[model samples]
Target chain A: MTEKDLIDACKRKNRQAQRLLYDRFSPVMMGVCRRYIKDPMEAEDVLVEGFFKVLTKIGMYNGDGSFEGWIRRIIINEALMHLRKNNQFKYAEEINPNLDYTEEPTVLDEIAAEEILNLLDEMPPGYRAVFNLYVVEGYKHREIADELGISINTSKSQLILAKQRMEELVKKRLGRHEI
Target chain B: MKTEKNISTLFQKGAERISVQPSGQAWQRLESRLEKEERRGRVVVMRWVASAAAMLVLVAAIWLWSASMQQHNFAILDAAPPQNLEDLENVDGCEPYCLVLKARAELPAYYANPVEKRN
Candidate 1:
């Protein structure tokens, strides 16, 4: 079925259509969840909850935007909610003064996609959330601040720290791989 | 040396390529939750229907009783003086003295011989 047809069927609560939608989106949504939640099981839980919402709230979709984008927003919000529920944002707001800001930027061209995800997984939850929102998800600092309930400056600073931390992690992984 | 733009582009590209297959059980859990929600929704609707039905029955019973009371009041008002205890039983709001008067009028011999009857 066409995407439109699939959505209409889902809106009608068609079980087959719902399952198809889940099968199609769960992997990508799981990837999105993992960027914010490091634990595979927790990420899976968020993925399931997110899909449940998508299916149940399908009627609210007014066809104003791409369905996939709408679903992505829901999944991202769910991940943020999970983090907030766990009090992960407390560490995200703390400014680490001792971070090496002057470290040379390492070439990330040679890194595999899996390695990049692993690097993201290793960062602090707060930094990872900010980084995922700002860089990967293309969210503005203001939007990230609102979603994370932090100041704009905090979002900006966390992005910077997250990048620095990513560089360090990439360098360490590269060094280990080269040896 | 990578600029901020280059770093973001790299990570964004990686994120685009990243897709992990969720465990098979994830769909099962979601399906069960959806079913439960559906069942709950049905239950809520049924509860509302039952409550409405009960309210309707109570209203109908009240209306019928009031209608019968009105009819009985009209009969009592139009009828002649009470000829028997059964007739007096339908006389609503009668004072005790009024009931005594009704009893004496309806059954004179019974009241007249009350003292001898007591003996």
Candidate 2:
């Protein structure tokens, strides 16, 4: 069925439509939730909350843009809310973009999910949350500020620090000697 | 190195992307919960409507009763204008019933219009 048709059916509170929606996008959204939260269990919990919010707030989606994008934004907000409750935001006033830059190789070519999780697991909670929000989730600094209730400058600096930390972890795993 | 290539793979996790949803029992529980919530919502709405209707009926009944009371009061006033207005005004300590000599006096032109003069 078309995306609009599915959206309409869901709006009508049809179970089949809801199931189809879950089947189609749960994995993608779960992947997003998992990145922000290190615990798979917690990620699943966030996904559930996000799904419930989407169902209740479906009326607000006006079909002006991509439906998936709308849902994705909701899921991202769900994750951020959970983190905010836990006091997991990292704030740095200004980030030297150069300081966060790392001359590292791409690990995506061969790294497994377990390996990536392992690298993520090593970081502290605040760093982990910021890293997932900035790089993995693709939220801009202003958007992150609004979501996390922090300043834009802080968002940029935190992202820079997160990248600097992630760079070291990825390099250590990949065992690369030179830049 | 500083290439943006690995970012996609980091997020996607490729074929490992799997979803775990609730079981049949859990889904049934959720459905039951939702059903209860919907029923509660309906009851609340019904109660509000019923209360509003009752208030409307009460206001209409009170208004109708008040109008009837006013009409009755007006009837009583019309039925016995003389008794109720008895001695309402006294001229020289006498009830103004001139025929019985209670207050017989020369009437002024305004009070005794020529058209109403008793010949």
What is each predicted model's overall lDDT from 0 to 1? 0.84, 0.68
lDDT of 1 by residue, A84-174 (tens): 9999875445465445556454554555668877988899899899889988889999999899888777887788888888877876776
DockQ class, candidate 1: acceptable
List of chain B TM-scores, one per candidate: 0.59, 0.53
Candidate 1 per-residue lDDT, tens place, B18-112, comes to 78999989999999999999999999999999999999999999999999999998996797865555655655675674777766676777666
lDDT of 2 at A72: 85
What TM-score would each prediction reach against the true structure? 0.78, 0.69
Candidate 2: tens digits of C-alpha lDDT, residues A1-179: 99989999988878788768877887778776766777777777787778777876787889888888899889878887887787776565576544545434454455566666677778776667666666656667788778777777777777667666777787777765233
Worst lDDT run of 10 residues, candidate 2 chain B, spans B15-24
* First chain of candidate 2, TM-score: 0.84
Chain A TM-score, cand. 1: 0.90
Cα distance off (Å), candidate 2, residue B33:
6.0
